[model samples]
Target chain A: MKTNKTSRAAQAFEKSLAARPTGRYVLRLFVAGATARSRQAVLRVRQLCEAELKDNCTLEVIDIYQQPNLARDNQIVATPTLIKEFPRPVRRFIGNLANITGLFVELDLGAKGKIAV
Target chain B: MKNNRPKSTSPVVHLPKCPTGIQGLDEITGGGLPRGRPTLVCGGAGCGKTLLAVEFLVRGAVQFGEPGVFMAFEETEAELKANVASLGFDLAGLVQRKKIVIDYVHIERSEVQESGEYDLEGLFVRLNHAIDSTGAKRVVLDTLEALFASLPNEAILRAELRRLFRWLKDKGVTAVITAERGRDQLTRHGLEEYVSDCVILLEHRVYDQIATRNLRVVKYRGALHGTNEFPFLIGDEGISVLPITSLGLNHKISSERIATGIPRLDAMLGGRGFFRGSSILLTGTPGTGKTIVAANFAQAACRRGERTLFFSFEESPNQIIRNMHSIGLRLEPLVKRGLLRFHAARPSLYGLEMHLATMFKEIVTFQPDVVVMDPITSLMDAGTASECRAMVTRLVDYLKAGQVTSLFTSLTQGGHALQQSEASMSSLMDAWLLLQDYEGNGERNRVLYVLKARGMAHSNQIREFLISDHGIDVVDAYIGASGVLTGSARAAQAALEKAAVLASQQEAAQLKREVERKRAALERQISGLRSDYETEAMELRRIAEQVGTRTFVLGTERAASGILRQADAKVAVGTRGKPGHGRRN
Candidate 1:
């Protein structure tokens, strides 16, 4: 067990060195209620983050109807707004995550979330 | 201009009114801004837009019993509180009472890195939260256009502004949005597009080194507003607008009479005095006692136990008091009694609007029963004649509406007669008392006459207005051969008349004596003639008696009648010859 713990610590250090120093992406999605558009945005964003980011992103979905304080805190005007909280510059997107590539480009994540097309 | 015009031909929708409680502002807006809609107040720097917005919220909470939320984009809460403290607005107390909510939204251009698209949604959410929390019926976004300076995208700003206005309308809360005036534009971003319900433009212009602030309602959607640019003031009582032409001819009339200080002048006006709440114009040339008349009016008002407000443009309070003391008007006592208030300012100290606003503010605060404006003509130096007229008209209207007597003294330029100047107040005044310096009998004497007094009988005679130790004294009308006389001429003419009467009396006495002497002389002549005739008759009587005696003797000698007859015949022939000789002679 001691040998396995030592190997795991060493592997984690190497992994941290291998990954980019910018760290994982942090994002928040705001919506009015559990409407179809909100659900689609949530599902699509989660799919893209898991598929591309691969456990390298933290996502929080806030329903303005329920947790309006959070939505207000984030300056959410319209439903299904995506806010990129990580990185040096904060960015905003005001639509459902239909065009994943365009969302990545707007969020300054170049080609990271691009599909095989 | 096109936006200002009503769109529909149908009956206009009467928007609900919200009284601003800013004195004349409500009247100018025809009952305050269109209710529950955004009103854009745009002005240049230091034109009082922020003060107006803040006053809106403050007055809403204090006077109207409506809770308000002030979302300042420029000034912080402490700054605003301190700024408005002098105006008697206790913002902190209001906030503590949950009657007001202030949220300062600071925008740091350098700190805000505009890397992606951003909207003013943050401001909206905060404002909405404050409004909801406070249940505010009024909202003020002071200097809202400051966001435009911080943000880089105009398109986004405009869209957000449009949405914000729509949201405010949907919320049904009276909102005042202040914006910076653009060059040749009502607002920097043309915010007038979004706030279509009402738009007020404030202008601060320095004319001849004197700054004058004016406010005009550029567009009021469904209300009949005063289109003229009114003068507004941010004074001890915050924003107060002075409406130039809103005072129509609908003020209530009072038949109550108030005495003028001079009893003689009062007699000239009528028996009692000028009508209560009437506008009296005292116009004259320089040194015609306009100030003295105004002082007397104020003194009389104070003596009547009515509060009086005197606005002297040409003289300071102390100077006026001292000068009036010479005329026996003891204004110091009245002032000490708190019955008279003097507001003295140079006409050049401010623009016409400022003067009007200050006067209005004093009137409102003092709540005087009568107002005296000395030398309103001095205000003509601050603006055009029409502008002065407008200001004076508004003042008169305000006083008339409140049933307060107003006396305005204007200076006439030239000559003794009251000339029709540019702003001829004769037609508007209820009573026009013209004072002129009549040069007659080698002396210039101040003469007073009532040019017109509506709905009352006034003395038409020109009175020699004299100032003595007993205050104003108006001598009786001195009608003479030439016309109405005044000054030393009246006195000299009166003396001449007395002398002529005395001379006529002496001449009558002398003629009477001469006629008595003539009658005595005639009587003497008649008596003399009578005596002479009596003497002559006595002589004739004696002759007749002798002749009779002779005839009797001759008759006794009838025997010798034949000889006598022959002699008588010769005598008859001789008599006939004597008669012929006498006829020839």
Candidate 2:
């Protein structure tokens, strides 16, 4: 019964992601030096998507030292910059994720859960 | 038609860094400083160096909703918040919201030792980190000049200023770096040498027995701004600049004339009345019944069903109305009828511009056909002579544009109330009415005189009037041995004249007849002032129509068609409801 439930959840997530024309909308947070603030921000975003979004949103975390070129391409001015990739008008919000409302507004992830799972 | 295109400074497109919305700062800068460059705000101790810088940052964060960074050189986080809470700004809330980033760098000058040539790299890094962290578009360097005192080397200080300004410019953040301005031009440390964008000088001067705060824009590189010495006042609302004078001699105006409400006054302009939007100044010393005269005019308009607004800076509405009532002019009925509105407030509530702005706002909101300022001199407490002049001049122009008839009362000093010195206000007034008190022969008499009425026939000769429980009454004066008689002295003088006349013989009959004829001519002039008051008043707007201002030297007038109409109207209105009809309408 547990295996069946896990497979069912995976199938639901995969179906929603595949239905989108761009496959899925992804937000990548590229952080440098892994500051406690940055790590907390990543965990906060992940939990916010799970408890808030449930599974409709997808968040990807990146260490800039692992890929310096990605940081440059996205014009990351500082640590912990969240890049909204799927939206036609791309925007970046840089902070330690202190303002959740500002982050949520910029990322376009409201309670309606418009982002692909 | 001019095509205004931005002259491209660089290939990079610039986003408008949110406006600070401070009053004088915007006006002096032609709209605000260069969008993202660090403009240094410098001044001496107790000269508002810190407050202004903080105000700039706070205004950006709160008023304009722009994220800002305040790098304090002296104040702590708690101290800064406590200091600004008095201004009704929630500085702590803004900090908690992450909309503002304040870094209090406490570095004592004596403790820091620099062994080698070093730039302000660490400070720049921290500032850049703050800016990058919050995406702040506005920055304030409160007293960066203190660092010069802290750091021993002059070369490093100057270099650091250049580098810091350049970095702020490159990041495209509008920054303000406060410093201590020196007696010489530019800052003491010559930061003005590094930043070639803008420099403003704030100064306080006491001249002609008045402490006037003035703002002088020493330079603004890429903008056109008012280069004159602007009178500024710092109060609860911060600094406000006085109105700008129209150096241009021409402004298109409406040729309409409206009634001053007082029939006799309207007659002074000829039967046609005053130009719809002209400003009439009623000047007199204290207790000369200027308020009573203005109330009479306003009440008349209210009786006529036209909206009238009374701005009393000297007296409250109830006080003014009650005082006028003591003299028998019932202003309460007019106020109750909803045609008259009085707005009373202290002049100190705002600076001159704000006062004018408030007046203009009320005027616009009420849309009154006639406006009255009970004592225009009340503005003396809020601003300097030049500022008051500019404000009054703007008010006149604005009223004329809107076609609202306005009356202004000024309190003049010294013994001469009839021809009181109106050097600061005379030029803007279309009609000048002088009220005075004359004491001679053991009695004090109040005399009312119209010195100058532009474009109208007026009574140049002073007239006698009485104030009683029944209001103002125009009566015959006792022409005694010398001075004009009024009130009780006039009564005694009249008795003496009658007694003397009863004793006169027939030999002086011809001389009396000649004098009577001349007196009749003067009476005819007065009557003509009433008769043509309306008709000639219609044509009396010599203000703009004249080729140039032909200064009417004293009391002389050319009788016109409406002058007779005005005389008849006054005789009719003055006796309209009187117990016994005094004159033939």
Candidate 3:
């Protein structure tokens, strides 16, 4: 029953993303220090924004080591976390973005068809 | 022997501790949790682990002049504030005053899709930021076990948790890490393995359908702490652990004495009554007036202008007041005057620990000079014998330490077991008064005697305990060859003695009258004899006169015959002398 509800909500979100393809996307990626994992997460999120939203997306990379207050104010609990801030329902994606397909589906970017890893 | 050898050679250096400022927790932990180190607090569901951690932070922030940071993983800041608000902790106010900072770590497993290896650097960063912002000396990571559920990879999670604890230690801030208890291990996620400097276990156990919360210091490295499980209560103020067993017998004793309300009962207790600040045990059988004795004690304390608190387990406050009124114990007036306070509750309302905690709270708030627990045996029924005895010991110790005289009424069953059952508790009391029913003459009568009174000369003789409209009257019980008598038997013996005395007095009065009559008869006999003698003498005198006159007349005719009959005048005078000499003979 939980999977069914999520699938229906995902379908609705996909339709809305398709309807407003030109709508601006605001994203924030929080990382800790200059670690390899943090660097990979930041690169992957920037790549997704440049490839998918092109000129309409604004991506901000924040290192919690430098601006630790942002981490406290934003309620960040895990490194390599990506937050879709501008969307009506702000969503958080935690951990390294290795599974590009799952990330696309989580971010509701599947309405633009499957993207190449 | 190896462990003891080192201690004998060198003095042990005490570990620096942070005081929790909690009622008894600090004492149990020998001070608070180890300073500047992470202490693992593990417990099962609804065991108050979260509350204990939160209170550590709140108390540190408000009381110790130390700022704190509360990082809640299970609850948000709003929820945490609202939850602690009921305990009279103004979390929002503390946060606004810059004394505390609350950072809520929201973790939703469904929202987070773990795709690759991730670290908990985010939590570390947030905690570090909160500490730096408020210069917090204390930090609480409430239930870090949520990370096990939020993050999928256990290997990375364990590694990160280990690092987090080490980092918290390096920061030099006292931290409390809460975790869920496991089936066999101390914590479900092996959190205790990481935070091993100190570990506290909280348990919520139900015994005989009553639940009691207990806290135990499972392990503390380089520090001594109470090893026994201490019962704790979450009251209006917060969690208060009862470190009762650890209390020493070193309370300051008061030499003052307080009356027991009944003057005769006081007279039996060395003319002054129970020692002030002493624990008095009043044990009796059913319907032997245990509550009456306790009520009398409370009234006496109140009359002396000392505050008295009455804890009734078997009856309501109003019911006790009404019943005492029948015996002329005016408790309502004392209650109205605020000198007496009554706290009434059912014995089965809660666990023994809760009841004890509530009593402690009442005693602290009322600050009474004397406390009376009516029928404490009923409260004893709420727990095992050992638990009840331990609770009573703690209560007695607490009252004595504060110089508050305490009176505990225990209801015992009929027969010899009364002394046997009270043997454990009676040792703790400074004075023990035994009230029992003497079944004789087809009636049961109440009798009281001072079984023991330490440091004072108390009467060993039993007194007939009488309850009348004018209050308790302690009269001397009849102890004779027929045995101890009370009630109607005592009255009858007194009447019999009075009757014997009256009979003996009447017999003495009758003998006095007889002696008076005998004296009167003797006097009458003597007077009659005297009169007879007088008459005889007068007749003799008249005959002599007649003889003289006849002799004189005959002498005229025949003077010689009269003279011969009467003789010469000198001869007659000589005859008179001869008659006088004859009468003298």
Best by lDDT: 3
Ten-residue region with minimum lDDT total, candidate 1 chain B: B110-119
- Which of the predicted structures, 1 or 2, would earn the higher lDDT when compared with the native? 1
Best by DockQ: 3
Per-residue lDDT tens digits for candidate 3, residues B309-420, read 9998988899999998988888898999999999999988998988998998899999999999988898877888888999999999999989999999998998999999
Please give the CA lDDT of all the candidate structures: 0.79, 0.69, 0.86
Candidate 2 lDDT, B1-585, residue by residue in tens: 011356576554333333557775675565676677767666556656567667777788877777888888778879989987776667898889999988876554433333222345446656777787788988888777667776666776677678778888899988877777777855786765358466666666654444555667676665566787776555555545553653244545556666655555566566566666778899887878788888878877787788999998978899988888887888888888888999998887666656786787789899998999978888977777667878888788888767788899998885644253585587788888888777776766778777777876776666775677876665556665666767777777778878888767554887899999999999999998888887677677654455344323111121222254455644554444233222221
Off by over 4 Å in 3: A1-28, A42-60, A72-75, A83-93, A104-117, B1-13, B245-247, B497-585
lDDT of each residue in B1-585, candidate 1, tens digit only: 113446587755567877788867888887787778888888889998888887888889999899999988788789999988989989889989999998876645543333333445456666778888889999988876777786666788788888888999999999888888888788777765356688888998876666778888888887788888887777777777766555578878889899998888888877789999999998888888899989988988898899999998888899999998987788899999999999999898878877887787789889999999888889988987777777777777889999999898988877534465723666668888888888867888888888888888888887888888878888875885698787777887889999999999999998998898898999999999999999999999999999998766654554254355565644554344444434433
TM-score of chain B of each: 0.76, 0.70, 0.84
* CAPRI class of candidate 3: medium
Q: Per-residue lDDT of A41-97 in model 3, one digit per residue for the tens?
A: 888887888788778888999999999989878878888888877754676777777
CAPRI-style class, candidate 2: incorrect
